[model samples]
Target: MSNSPQKYKTEINFSNDWDISTQDKYIFQFFHQQLEDLEANQLHVHGVKLYKVESSIVVTAILRHSLPKKLLLEQVVLLVKNKDGKELAKKQFDMALFGELEPCTARPWKFLFEEADLLVPLDEIENEMDFEMAFEYYEKVISDFELYLDENWSNGLTVDQQGYVKNLVSSLEPIKVNEISIVGFHFEESEQAVNIFIIIRNAFSQALTIENLPIQLFDATGDIVCKLGFPIGEFQIASKQARPISLSFSKEVFQKENPDFSSWKIEMVPQTL
Candidate 1:
């Protein structure tokens, strides 16, 4: 009892959001000498406790890294399952929130699996329970912006460029889910014409094909600059996806009362039935 391995900082050991009462603790499983994951991370599940607050199941465990060198992990998926390997709860976590792990060091942390996060209802659980927790790193977590790009663009994007786009998308308003929207982010103005780079999003739950689309361009000051329409027989788009496009407005069509090209938008003009 004299020797216990060094633990990580105590600040990460508990959560302020979990108002778990000490008297409400119930059935739990104790795990030790568990298996090492592919990333050399080992999880020894000390136990799990149940509390009435939010039907939350808080697991107390010691996470250790067996590798010879220090590891810095971020946005890691923590998967929890029963002994039979049926997934019970899953959540993505940033390691920094838990604390540091030097080579071969272990840290104890309490993970709160709230009722809303549980795949299986709490009423279905028996008084006795056991759990296994592991990390899933390969699974991709799509961002709000990543859902906007179609397959072609997602496959060809560079990491840096993709990150840049993701940041830009975060600052913009959430994309409407029921209507089709055209968002223009860039414009290339030449003496001959103004080429607008646009992203068209289909928020409908099913695939859509718009054969003809009439649009009106408006500048930052809310003045109409041009009106154009497209015969888009080939512009078939999948449900809940977006595609990048370019629309050119020739000088003759673009009414330039010295129209500001720095910031502009295009709106889809309603068609008469």
Candidate 2:
């Protein structure tokens, strides 16, 4: 038999050098630090996403617990930067995600920046790493922005001057009933009268007028135990104020079936507009 030359064939495949797990870890850590910073100021950030559109960059995030009681934030500041550790732009959102928010709820927020708003061209950003580094730089500047708001809230609306005018008008307007609450009651046997204490909260910016307010008391079975009316003749409650009122009722007005006022519930009757 004639000797034959040996023949061999081999196949090779190449894998990407990037580690996806490492990228994920970096993103997670960046967001964790952002959340921690927000928590220090009693705010919460749930999620964030970045997108490049044409000549602009859009940032969408979920904000949680952004508003606190007795404080309203009419504007928010957004800072953008480049991978070279240079600030790119700063934008202001005139309105919040919602006009009003229930406590402990999440709301979606969006911030848009155009080419003119950025310091560098979008093409200069090479990869995800560059974008991430820019966002990291933003984290440090946001705290100063928050402090600026605390001190210059009245001037926060520079771009939209109309907002400032509207705010001024609202502050000068009349107050309205925001909430009504019944505190407790005291029965004066010697005076043959029962004094019911109530707290009325006016959330408006201006004073409110309350006149001839009617209140009713009910028993455990929802039966009418007593009825009384308060003559707050021309009484005006100041803006963002909580005022206490005491209504007196004679013992003769109490129903004989439920004369005891110990287990009674009190409520304010709605007034006709």
Candidate 3:
């Protein structure tokens, strides 16, 4: 439940249009294909990419082998999900079946979810062409990544990034919230806005209700840059089951006091219920 990945790495590619059931099947099919092509003791997926853009989820990973002539694989699977984890559609296939040749586009594995049924970029050459083999491997796997987003029609929740806070709530390991501050700041000479993001952990599982989650700015010497505070509205959670909440600030207010400020140190100024 902690945001920090206990496993080596896991990335999920998702689209908002499909329901969760369709998404589950897509996952099963995609993994099933990889299981088929993976060579004995040679398959690896220590580092992979997963994300959702619009209505589709795209997954990319690197697979290597101990042999010089090992077959390289690329897989592309399309996915769709609804607001509450419903799956609506899915498509998947391998590149080897496509005439055994890589697509000539700048991105070899190119499939726009809106345009085609599915997209798959994995290609295996019988022999190593040269020392530059890895470059081709990466290009094949990574280049068409943006297509995943360009094809879908719905805007889904950025679940993976937002879920990070949930992990903080589930942490069994102790975390030190060394510092937190929220303050106004100007970015790139643009409009003033909240320049800080503060995450306060309820590691003890005790309910914390702070009335004013202030907009704090820190100076070069680690001093408070401004006295202004954001009106963090009422918060509630009576017991240990509560999850951590987040606070947002305006950029202009933060940057006016500390132009260089990017982060903040927050403290719980206690208030009784």
Candidate 4:
């Protein structure tokens, strides 16, 4: 759903994190309530502030629910742009993953836009906060049956191959947010390395950067066939979305037994204590 906010006339607050003198409680207020003879279900945004930092701009805004009941959306995309219509950042949020938003209730939210996500330098930003915030709501409910693929993971898959994976996930159990699971998607053996394509599911609410994460491969009988530590960057699985990732190991690790991993079952392993 697109955002058709009825913008208010208040001046937006623009201040550095250390400078609070010029800051106001709210820079802009958006009223998306149902008007006369019209229907409106948009999520209202109010009391916004842009706090700029060295590497990121933190957006502090209030999110209000206008739906009849408590709204829990798992997929919502927010786009931020400058006054001149230059794009700043666009980020997706899992509303249900974070918490429930009650009807007509207002809550504060913060969106961090890193330097990599910004399209232009920070200096060009308007002091009066002359930018716009737009929200896009998606109806697709994320559940245990879905696997959101990282760009790197889906780049190599054919359209048919992707569809097969989607179908394959229906029979698999849901991976919880606190659990880290590495299930085999596909694998190939070579003279030097065995590249194992994996579907990594992480339900954690926040993204984490790590060095080595354990990946366990087990046979149908629940016996671990092999265990390996793979170096991973950031593992961020959306609320109910699993992601496909690839891990490669030296062929020597599997020299003892050549196993057909397609029929193997994946077991959940805790990320930490």
Candidate 5:
């Protein structure tokens, strides 16, 4: 018979020490140990790729697992350093490696370091960049990776799917107002009705007048026990201020015989206007 070459590749065999319940935990621990070992040896530039886009730098790389077993990843921290051997910036990312990962698998990861993320100017990129050095040293840590620069690259901050870059902002900026919440609440029982006191805080700078606000009360079993609707009545709340409003409901409105007040929850129905 004529000799034939093998077409199928051999399956990877993992050692006994690599047994873990979830792939996320295993990958997290593996990367954590690798990073710790790199830091101990004063080499921090492995598994990282830097691309000098327009004014900002875009980093893209893959975190991989080579073991034969599937693993889970929870979170990982990336550190950026300057040419002076000084730490410049650090960011933590939540990994979505929840399910079982096949052997020799990889996950693509990207991070955008804007002007704010980088404390120093982009022109100052020098040979002392620790991330570059780390990548060179640990080239085998990741499989099939390459780095490229793009002058037309825009900031990845606006990308909603990339949650890691969403929080990258300046420290001096003020917190933006999104919505209002009930700060305090109380209830008083009278002979015929129950008084509901709701204290709301306006987080925005301008006055907010919500009309026909719907509030629902739920019992311990998550059943709607009572519903109340009232208008804010064109109330003007000053910038960064709080206001307390009171409403009353009939005692017969509650459907539960003996509702557990401690376990009850108040739900504010979302309104557009």
Candidate 6:
């Protein structure tokens, strides 16, 4: 009954608009219009180096918009919270946007996490872990922007530049405690049950004074065993500050609820400066 030749429809894949090199040229102008139309993009947490002992999240990313020329961005707001969504803390960081005329030229943003503002509770510091890095790009016009990864960046800075900035960063005052130690003890009555000792240090050169640090303890099954701390060592953690702190708890508590204490986390709240 059909006289016409058989026909087929073609499918097409769309690429991210922002990810392309040519897109950068016009991204700025687009951003300008966005500022007028949309609400300020709030990226919760700029740089987070938190541990799993505490339930926390970090928000960080590059917020950009393009048009014909001129790029514009404002500081992004980073927020952290507990599992219940109770706001733990927040930080605001300057937005960095890069535009390139060519594809492979040098266009790197040096990200320096404000070391001093991390306000994680002392109890959460008992576990071993690292901070989570999450970000949201608003007015996401281009598609491929997420693919832009810089393997060359280390500790939030370029490799070579990171090396050069090492001394400069070290010369700066104590930002926050960069390390934690956990010692273990075995009970003679129960060979399988071991009591863990914990010590958190603020090894910075300058003073890192903070208030209301929330430290929560988790069992092997990722349940909140105990949320400790209201009186977080209220003192100035001077640069190169290394001091011993304590956590008093029982292995039986963690062993009874969850045998998997091996996978624990501790997240500290970063301060807003």
- Scored by lDDT, the top model is 1
- RMSD (Cα, Å) for all candidates, in order, is 17.6, 21.5, 19.4, 16.2, 19.8, 21.8
Clashing pairs in 5: 23-71, 23-72, 24-71, 24-72, 24-73, 45-134, 45-135, 46-134, 46-135
Work out the TM-score per prediction. Answer: 0.42, 0.35, 0.28, 0.39, 0.36, 0.26
Cα lDDT of all candidates, in order? 0.62, 0.50, 0.35, 0.59, 0.49, 0.36
What's the candidate order when arranged by decreasing TM-score? Answer: 1, 4, 5, 2, 3, 6
Q: Which digits, one per residue and each the tens of the lDDT, describe model 3 over residues 54-89?
A: 444344433333332324345534343333433333
Question: lDDT at 124 for candidate 1?
Answer: 54
Candidate 1 similarity to native, TM-score: 0.42
Question: Tens digits of per-residue lDDT for model 5 on 39-118?
Answer: 11121223345667777777644444545556565555566765456555455555453244465444435666666667
State model 1's lDDT. 0.62
- Candidate that scores best on TM-score: 1
Mark the regions of model 6 whose C-alpha exceeds 4 Å error after superposition: 1-206, 210-213, 230-233, 238-244, 250-263, 267-273
Between prediction 4 and prediction 6, the one with superior lDDT is 4
Model 4 TM-score, 2 decimals: 0.39
Candidate 1 C-alpha lDDT tens digits along 41-107: 3433333433334486666655656556665566566677778888877776666666555666554
Clashes of 3: 44
Question: What lDDT does candidate 6 reach at residue 108?
Answer: 19
Model 1 clash pairs are none
Q: Show model 4 residue runs off by greater than 4 Å.
A: 1-146, 207-210, 219-225, 254-273
Q: Give the TM-score of candidate 6.
A: 0.26
Order candidates by lDDT, high to low: 1, 4, 2, 5, 6, 3
Question: Where does the lowest 10-residue lDDT sum fall in candidate 6?
Answer: 140-149
